[model samples]
Target: MKFTKILAAIVTTAALFSTSVASHADALTDRAKSGKPIRIGFAHEIPWAYPGDKNEPLGFANAIAVGVLKSMGYTNIEPVVTDWGGLIPGLQADRFDIITGGMYITGKRCKNVAFAEPMGKFGNAFIVKKGNPLGIHTYKDIKDKDATMVTVAGYVNVDEALKEGVPENKIMQVPSNTEMLAAVRAGRADAGAGTYFDARNLSESAPNEIEPTDPASLPEWTNNWVAIAFKKEDQDFLKAYNAAQAKYLGTPEMLEAVGKFQYTKAQLPGDAKADWICANR
Candidate 1:
């Protein structure tokens, strides 16, 4: 009687285990079919996250984000705009499920949240005049510019430009890169410092209004990294995102997608084909 009772107990446990696995699988399928939109919060920064002409949250990262998430089986996705500085607080409050914007994963940032594996990298670039006619090649070049330097307000790039030794009084902070670029073109400033991709793309798309160049003299790199942040302790979502990133990064198709979005030059680790894939993908 004891042996028979034990065998029946074991059978009951096996049935319960099967039922749990089946339920979990059903949940995954149900979530995929829900048609409920995954609302993503975004902060504006050109070439990555920013508003469209109509003020819709739009840009490369915004675009890439929709594509990637949809490919992962989400159909309803929304881009909600928010102030850059307030993004984290909103995430912490559960205002959005994810941040589909351009942000780096750093040690300081990790204190508040978790991060996905690196998506790509970025390098700071200098926007100089035609022919680099100033002969300025380093961070020290700003002191030698004989003119002001421009950057956007509240951006680390401004701090970086300032650290290069330009007097605080000589630095101009504006609301956007457009304004900063205008200052450079109008000769209000000798040059501007910002993302490498933005400088290069502006030169390619606009032609002659602003020229893209690198500071050849700075002893330190401005900053270069790639990764995205998430709300605290959200390991379930983090696992999925990291899995998606690693899987995507290994494919030729991923490179093609990056090209489609034009993130090639800014994505780091020196993969020309990776660039091509990023651009094309």
Candidate 2:
């Protein structure tokens, strides 16, 4: 009788464990269909995915995610805010189902996470004081003048500057564009390098304090494309999201969603495959 009881207990425990494993496997697909809240991670990059006045996260990436997910019946989206460096690590730990911010897709990142099709494309721009005090229109100017410039800690802007012969001592790595702009304003940095959208948003808020230098005039700073990031195991979720993205991108609704940040149709990425981008990067 005691032996029978033990066997029954073991079977029950095994069944429970199996059920838990199945639920874990289902994750976004099952949860999304069942009306569970989808968690997305984002950094506080201006006009990308930052908290608005109401403390609700609103920005270009957030808008796109909301539109696509809502169209697919996944209305319950929970935003997980983190710093720039924490985005990938948080996603790997299952802290969020997706990184909704404009994470740039590169060969290195491709090995770690699967990326959706390219959504936004941008080149590096500089945030300088109103009158361009240092006459810093390009990275070369920063290098030539031996002026210090600020860039976000994890962004490729720092790399762009380094490649242009801007020494390490001349580059200050801050955490956000807000601080970078502040660094320039405080004379801690001669300029701040970031995405064109970032410069536009920052300058618009304080037009008298700063302005964005035209990146189009630079010869070496080619445009870089950005895409939504997903875990490698979420193949099914990626497919569903991509299908929705195809329908949502370049539509009137898409423009309306991101237009508040001054995103133009020209900023939309072309039909370049992620693999090609990864290799070319």
Mind giving the per-residue lDDT tens digits that candidate 1 earns over 85-194? Answer: 66677778877767766765444455675656656666667677777778655556778765677776645565665666778887787766677777777788777776
TM-score leader: 2
> How well does candidate 1 score on lDDT at residue 29?
38
Compute each candidate's TM-score over C-alphas: 0.69, 0.85
Q: What is the Å distance of residue 115 in model 1 from its true position?
A: 2.7
Worst 10 residues of 1 by lDDT: 272-281
Deviation from native of the Cα of residue 143 in model 2, angstroms: 1.9
lDDT of all predictions, in order shown? 0.64, 0.85
Which ranges of candidate 2 are over 4 A from the true structure?
1-26
For residues 8-81, what per-residue lDDT tens digits would candidate 2 score against the true structure? 99999999999997777546788677777899899988778877666676888888888888888787888889
